[model samples]
Structures are given as C-alpha cells and as structure tokens.
Target: AQTVTQSQPEMSVQEAETVTLSCTYDTSESDYYLFWYKQPPSRQMILVIRQEAYKQQNATENRFSVNFQKAAKSFSLKISDSQLGDAAMYFCAYRSPGGTASKLTFGTGTRLQVTL
Candidate 1:
C-alpha cells in the first residue's frame, strides 16, 4: 500500500518570505509520480509541482520547488517569495501511473497562512 504523510498540519509565512512544507510517502513501486496540490477557498485543486520517481533532478515551477529523497522516501515542497495568494491548503499526492487505475494517494494536507 502507498501512503503520503504531511507532518505539519498548519504553517505560516510572511509576505515575500519562504516556506517549506514537508511530505513523505511510502511506496514499493520504482516508478511513480509525486505532486503538490494547492486548494484555496475556491476548492480547486491546483498542481503546484510534480516529480518523476526516476528523475534525479528535483522538480520546480516558478516559486515552487521540491526536494525529493528517493532513499528516504521524502518529498518536501519549498515555496519562495511567498505571497498572500499562496495561502491555501496544500496536499501531497502520489500516483502509480501504471496500467491499473491506481487512484491518487493524498496526505492530510497542510494549511498555509500568508501574513502581511
């Protein structure tokens, strides 16, 4: 079984600062996909960034980046230049991307508050 974990249930950051949301997943599959999703008040799941298990390089998207430690089964999201708009519930998700319809495994999520 695969599972995602987010130890921090809540986080806060000042404007223009940086914040890192920790995530870890346990999976036996060698090839999979890791993702960070943001859901604001609108409740729309937005893809913040993604990492391919086989890729050695970490994934980054604009102000968002991830530190993927394959051996440790750790994947953390770093948000730079944080803005008020970044305040939302961030979830760490995993997908097998195989033939079977492996539904996404998501963490409990972490609520981020951007303070002025």
Candidate 2:
C-alpha cells in the first residue's frame, strides 16, 4: 500500500514571503506520480505541480516548486512570493499513473495562511 503524509497541519506566511510544506510517502512501487494540489475556500481541487518518479529534476510551475528526494520518498512543496491568493488547503497526493482511473490518494492536508 502507498500513503502520503503531510506533517504540518497548518502553515502561515506573510505576503511576498516564502513557505515550504513538508510531505513524505511510503510506497513500494518504484513508478508513480507525486502531486501538490490546492483547494481554495471554493473547494475546487487544482493541481499546483506534479513530479514523475522517473524524473530526477524537480518540477516547477511559476512560484511553485518541489524538492523530490526519491531515496527518502519525500516530496515537499515550496511556494515563493506567496500571496493572499495562495491561502488554501494544500494537499499532497499520489497516483499510479497507469492504474485504473488514475485515482488520486491524498494526504491529510496542510492549510496555508497568507497574511499581509
């Protein structure tokens, strides 16, 4: 079985600051996908970024980036230049891409608070 864990239940950052959310996983499978998703108050699940297991380079999207430690099975999200709009429930997710439905397994979630 595979499981994702977000140790931080909540985090806060000032506007234009930076924050890193920690995530760890346990998976025996060598091939899988890791993702960082954001859910605003509206509760729409949006993909912040994704990393493929076979990729050695971390993934980056705009202000979002990931530090993927494959040996440690850890995937962390770093949000630079955080803004009020970044406040949301961030979830670390996993999926076996070739599996049925590409079903996503989510972490407990880390709520990010952006302050002025």
Provide the clashing-pair count of each candidate structure. Answer: 0, 0
lDDT of candidate 1 at residue 65, scale 0 to 100: 95
lDDT, residue 55, candidate 1: 98
Q: Which residue runs does candidate 2 get wrong by more than 4 Å?
A: none
Residues 1-116, model 2: lDDT tens digits: 78899999999999999999999999888889999999999999999999999999999999999999999999999999999999999999999869474888899999999999
lDDT per residue, candidate 1, 77-97, as tens digits? Answer: 999999999999999999997
lDDT of each: 0.95, 0.95
Candidate 1: worst 10 consecutive residues by lDDT?
96-105
TM-score of each: 0.97, 0.97
